[model samples]
Target: MGIVWRAARLVERRPQTATASSLVFVVPGWPGHLPGQHVDVRLTADDGYQTVRSYSLAAPGDGDRIELGVQVVPDGEVSPYLAHDLPPGSDVEVRGPLGSWFVRRPDQTEPVLLVAGGSGVVPLAAMIRARSRTGTHSPFYLLYSARSPDEVWYRDHLANPDPQVDVRIVYTQQAPPGSTRRPGRVTRGDLDKQAAQLQPDSPVYVCGPTGFVESVSNLLIDMGWNPAAIRTERFG
Candidate 1:
């Protein structure tokens, strides 16, 4: 459905990490959404320069409200506005519950491997939430890399990495004082370790900044998995 009205409040805005905010809107006439979908937001200033942007849905839908994970880009047109100008109880126009191409369902039995870079873990997090909600016991592996411990999104929930779901974090810029996972970049060797630990038949989902997604995807193909078995989404 298209956006006929705007939300009354911005509702809730919470920062997940230093660079991103988790926003939930209590919009009336809200339509349901799949985990990995996104919505287009239209922003207008009083002076008449208008802009529109698309952002991924952070939380899965049970029907009422929609949640978005937004990263504040310095000097970015939309992000900065969201970070500074837009506030809880503020009004904005959004049209969505849109995008059919990227929705994920865990109805099948295949194990899922999720690889993410920086703030790009937004959508992949939703997929993980979906798997958890359905009580599906499929094995999941999450390889997320960030610049520092403070920069990694979803860091808190990953406190205990289960046998079925593996979580590995890499710090490219700097690791905190005495960290465990290796420092530097997310290399092919890291992907190899994840692949080795996972069952051979699992399907993989990779989302992140362009370079990390490309590098990881290439590494997977080079490691002998079929190209079609790996799915990807890039967030710029």
Candidate 2:
């Protein structure tokens, strides 16, 4: 599809964690997108200096309105402003619903495994919501890795009890109270337990920082998941 820049206004904003936020924008002419799609946000300064960054759509499409989950990169050029300085009614140029290979279509019926690190859960969260939104019964297992309990995004949505989707969290820095697993990066043992619920052919999607994605993807491949079947997206 031929995508062009469009005007988007921040209609609402909410904190997801200490360093992250969810921004809701209402674009006048947003083309609906699939789960895992992202948009390019262009920020222009007072002197006309401009910069752009890509952010995955945090929510399933709803008319001209969309949501983005942003993690403040302490020294980043754009993220800091979007997560901290941007206010309701502010205008920013957006151009996307971009990306293709990592998306999940609504009609897909096979079981799915999604592994996310830190804010990487943003897009996977959209996939989970899209599943529920369209009434698709495909079973999903989401294993999320965050630095600590307070850093997990979409806390309520992931915690909501659901028989169809199994959600798990691994803390790399601080584990939640009474949690069994001590603070650590995800390991083969973790995958062993979750992989038991899935068949050999089930598709797996992994997203996170470049290093985290690489580490998780290698782990999945070692566990007999087909290399071509494991889709991945990485940032930073």
Maximum-TM-score candidate: 2
lDDT of 2 by residue, 1-236 (tens): 58999999999998999999999999998989999999999989999999999999988889999999999997888898899899899999999889988899877889899999999999999999888888887789999999998998988888893679999999999998999999999999888878898876788999999999999988888888888889999988
**Which residue window of length 10 is worst by lDDT in model 1?**
1-10
Per-candidate TM-scores read: 0.89, 0.97
Tell me model 1's lDDT, rounded to 2 decimals.
0.78
**Candidates' C-alpha lDDT:** 0.78, 0.91
| Cα displacement (Å) at residue 118, model 2 | 0.2
Q: Residue 232 lDDT in model 2?
A: 94
Model 1 lDDT at residue 154: 69
